[model samples]
Target: MRAVRYHEGGDPDVLDLEDIERPDPGRGDVLVEIEAASVNPVDAKFRAAGLPRLPKTTGSDLAGTVVAVGEGVDDYAEGDRVFATGLHTGRFAGGSFAEYAAVPTDLLAHLPEGVSFEHGAAVALVGVTAWRALVHHAGLEPGGTALVHGGNGGVGHVAVGLADALGATPVATARPQYHDALGDLGAGTVLDYGRDDLADAARDATGGADAVLDHMPDTYLGTDVAAAGFGGDIVAIAGDTATFPDVAAARSAELDVHMMSMSNLATHSDAPDIGPILDRIGNLLAEGRLDVTIDRTYGLDEAAEAHRAVLEESFLGKLVVEP
Candidate 1:
């Protein structure tokens, strides 16, 4: 099997494509012959900084078919098609950027009947992250307003679409060109993050969004905090501990700031209701209620190039690498 792996972490050059032994499935695992994989920002970060393993293969999203099943695995059989997030449980296992991988059945999900392999690979990680952020963490309601920062990116685009699907009024921030683009995706209004004063723009758009989903915590913590309405929820998927924008503003307004990781430790615990979230997202895709956006695609051998493209921040949506 041909796979991309790195013995040590550093830059994009560290990822090397090599021929390696194909892995066999363990008990309760499924060996998938990968058809496509998507490169995420976290994949690059982990590959460059190193995750839990050395000589690691880094990729989180995949769409593939089962080629072998391990002992006691009944939910899937040989030749079953599927798409899944390899990081749902988070110990790296030669992730999706390869010809084959042995993934625990608990981390796999059945792909919808009509969804394409590229779309499946593109949607899993970002889709689930958006769904959990808005529906579960932010607790968005039909009559409420939500703001999605970086709305042109993978997770942001999905958050905009999903919020609209759930009947919430979505307001997203992006480049000026993306205003009409996101408007088509169900954003009632779009604010250009580069030009507009986000605080003022958000206030005008949805009378100050009740919930704000942010991807750039290093910069937007203050912007989101100021843009939020009283008692609003500001959910962040990135960043470490940082000072509050204005302690007085947060305290006086009673705002809540949620730190979300969407990591294995966060999702895979005694709380077994992951099925409900995945099922809802699956049904949405199955019924065409959820949108799967593939901004670009690359050949399997161009995996390193795909990583570079994503790192350069030139993508409008998910970037997929097809085998």
Candidate 2:
């Protein structure tokens, strides 16, 4: 089997494609013949910081067919088409940037018919994150207003559609070039994040946003606080050291703030079951209610270039790797 691995990560250049012995599935696992994997910002971050173990593979999202199943994996069998975010194992055994991956049953879901392998891999992690932020943490309700920062990025784009699907009016912030596209994806209002009047425009859209989905809380925390309605929910998915610029304002408004990461749920023992969420996402994809835009596709050998594009480029949607 061939895989992209980094022995001691420092940059994208550290990724190398090499031939390695194929892995066998362990108990409650299934061996997937990987067809497509998507590059994420986390992949590049981990590549730069280096993993605790040497020579770890570089991707987490994957879609493929099951070639074999291990003991206790009775729900899935040979030839089952599956897609999953594979970072839960914590040992890198489920890395998808390879010809095959051994994924646990708990993290795996049956890919709905008519969903392409590329779309499946592209949406796994980002889709799940957006769904959790808006539907679970934010408690977005029908007819409410949602303010989404970074509305043209991977998770932002999906959040726009999901907010609309849930009957909420979506007010998104993006570059001017993406305004029309965001509107097409169900955003009722799109504002330029660079504009000085961004918060004003957001507030004017719905009096104030009922919920704010923030991707770069480090830079947008104040904007989120200024644009949200009284007692609104603000969910921050990024920014490790994110802080409120005006704690008094947030407190006075009685805003609810939350910080989350998909990796935390993947690794935590007490995390809620994600199987139901994946099933809902798959249903939406199958029914054409949700879409994942593919900005580009790369070969497995060009994984390094894919990593570079994910971090250094401003492409919309996801970059996929077909093995």
Candidate 3:
């Protein structure tokens, strides 16, 4: 298997294309012949900030056919198409950037009949992230309102789609060029962060959202705070922040900040029972109720190029690498 790996965390240039031994499935594991994998910010983060352990393979989300199932695995079989995301487990654990990967059966989901390999690969990471934020953390309600930052981003787009399907009005922030795309994705109003003020824009759009789903919470905390309706919640899926805007001052107007890391079994509740979420999203894809957008596609060998594209913020949606 050819994998893009690095001995140390640094710039994207550090990624080296090399042939490595294919991973073998262990008990309760499934060996997938990867057809496509998606590049995410975490892929780059793990490269630039991976553990001291050298020679780490970087990739989380993958879509492929099951070529083999290990001992104790009875739920899946050879030739089954599957979608998966890495759980940050073992060394060489996340070798999805290559032709094969051995993933735990618990992290795997069946790809819907109509969902293409690329779409399956693209949806898992972001879908799970959005589901955790909207359904698990904030408990977003039907007929509620959510203000989403980076509405054009991979996770943000999925959040908008799910929020709409769940009967919430979504207001999103993006660049002017992506405004129409957000609207088409079911965002009731699109605010251009580069051109408009988010707080005022969100307030005017949905009369203040019941919750705010933010990617860069540190950068937009104040705006999200101002845009939230009294007692509304704020969920941050990405970013590292100790505290948000002052809460004591907003008495009777609660502004609680929730982080997606809470979804990790190590920190918060046990890993959610995602079987139902995947089934629902699978139906949405099968019926065209949801759209998985691929901004660009690269061949497996060009994994470094894919990382560079994402690091440079050039792609519009999920960036995929076909093996």
Candidate 4:
């Protein structure tokens, strides 16, 4: 099998597609013949900064068919359509930018009947992240309002739709070009993040958002604090650490602030079970209630280019690799 690997991290150029021995499924694992994989910001970040181990395979989320299952695994069978994220898992683990990957059974889920391999792969990580942020951590309720920043990005778009599907009104921030699309995805209000009145407008739209899903908390934390209603929850999914700009206001409102990383949950023993979450997302996809937009697709040979585009280019939704 051919896989993209980086012996040492530096840049997208470090990724090399080379012939490698196919891995066999170990105990509690499933060997997937990867049909499609998606590129994520984490893929590029890990590619450039390096992981704990060297000579690592690139890519993370994958959708394919189970060719074989390891010992102690009976939940899945050969030829079952499946999709998974966090391919860097327990024994026999490898990244998804390959012809095949041996992923742990815990990370695997049945790809719904109508979902394509490309869409299945594209939604894995981003869908899980959005679901965790809005539904799990924030506890956004029906008839509540959700303020989502970066509403055109992968997770943002999904969050908007998920919030709407949950019966909450979604107020989103994105560039002008994406307002119509965001509205179509169920964002009740779409604002430009650059507007000086962003905080005020978001508050007015929903009478103060019940939850704020922030992607760039370093830049938007204060705004999020300002936009949220009393006792509102703020979930920050990305961005660098910065001092909270309005500690007094946050305190006054009795806000609940949280920071989360899906990768951490996938790897940590104390984390909640994600299998059921993925199952719910699969159901939503199958029902056409959740959708993932594929901005582009790349072949295995263009894995390096995929990495470059994911970080350096401006594109909506997810980029997929058809292996």
State which candidate has the highest TM-score.
Answer: 4
Which consecutive 10 residues in model 3 have the weakest lDDT in total? Answer: 261-270
Name the lDDT value of residue 264 in candidate 2: 67
Tens-place lDDT per residue, model 2, 83-190, is 888462364434789999988877769999899999999988888898889988999999999999988888899899889988999999999999999999899999
Superposed model 2: Cα runs more than 4 Å off? 88-93
Q: Would you estimate the TM-scores of all the predictions?
A: 0.94, 0.97, 0.93, 0.97
| Superior candidate under TM-score, 1 versus 4 | 4
TM-score of 2: 0.97
Of candidates 3 and 1, the better by lDDT: 1
- Residue-level error in angstroms, candidate 1, position 253: 2.2
Clashes of each: 0, 0, 0, 0
In angstroms, the error of model 3 at 6 is 1.5
Compute the lDDT of residue 145 as modeled in candidate 4.
97
lDDT of 3 by residue, 30-76 (tens): 99999888888878877888643567777777889999999999999
Task: Evaluate candidate 4 by giving its C-alpha RMSD to the native, one decimal.
Answer: 1.3
The positional error of residue 25 in candidate 3, measured at the CA in angstroms, is 1.2
Ten-residue stretch with the least lDDT total in model 1: 265-274
Question: Model 3: residues >4 Å from true position, as ranges?
Answer: 87-92, 262-269, 273-276
